[model samples]
Target: MGRILLIGGIGAGKTSIKQMLMNEQVSYQKTQMLDFSHVFIDCPGEYLEIPRFYHVLIDASHQVSEIWALQDATKERSFYPPKFSKVFRKPVIGIITKVDLPKANIKRASSFLNYAGIEEPFYTTSVMNKDGVAPLRMRLRELNELYND
Candidate 1:
């Protein structure tokens, strides 16, 4: 099983993506523990809580294969908070969520990526519209295949 870490600021649609993947309703009270699948761990926690929680998982059997940065494109460059980059050495992919939102600018999206020091291509996704999930899934599956190889 591949462990996918969903990291982002509050209200960046992490839960929406998780719900889309699971095909179930998103609820904090119900899924506080963790959601398991062939592809994800679905640990949907705020920025502060993630560090401590991730360290505990350090001694666990699974290692995080990918880190998905669920970013809000409409937000300013300063809005992208600093993350603990030392946590993982694997691939970290930036995902610009809420693509269906009106007034979404691609320039801001690129700026956000530059500010985050990410050079890889990011997905402009809207879980509400289902525009970008398929390509992302294919990319993720490719990553999983590479990891196994």
Candidate 2:
């Protein structure tokens, strides 16, 4: 399968999602640098929060087939600027994480993603409940098949 890169602000559940997808034990741990595996490229949130580190992400994007832009559903503000996804040439998928939280506002999160230049069909997920993870796995499988040939 082609590598999928995950990027977002800190505590957006990027690491947790990667762990779950890899069938590893999910735990809270801060990502200090770029992490690579056979199927995913897990980026540290600092890369997105700090402007100077943007080049790091753009450079890394070339190694992956697609990008997953994550947004914490409960966050009051977004780290991404307008049309942020346009910087990468690969396909960008929008994901709203921690949707199971009572404070999560899906509509607001969707708006943030839209402002970041992500289109329709956002995926909502909660690692605690494993909600909305299956479809992502299926999508990844489809991507693998589509690009493997």
Tens-place lDDT per residue, model 1, 1-149, is 36676666556677778777667765444235455566666544544245556554332224567767667766554344344433457566788887787867766876666566665578888877787988877877687787773
Against the true structure, what is each candidate's TM-score? 0.71, 0.97
| lDDT value for model 2 | 0.94
State the lDDT at 50 in candidate 1: 53
The TM-score between candidate 2 and the true structure equals 0.97
lDDT agreement of model 1 with the native: 0.63
Would you list the C-alpha lDDT of every candidate in the order shown? 0.63, 0.94
Q: Find the candidate with the highest lDDT and give its number.
A: 2
Q: Which 10 successive residues of model 2 have the least lDDT summed?
A: 140-149
Lowest summed lDDT across 10 adjacent residues in model 1 is found at 78-87
Residue range 1-149, candidate 2, lDDT tens digits: 48899999988999999999889999999999999988899989999999999999999999999999999999999999999999999999999999999999999999999999999899999999999999999988888898883
Off by over 4 Å in 2: none
Model 1: how far residue 136 lies from native, Å: 1.0
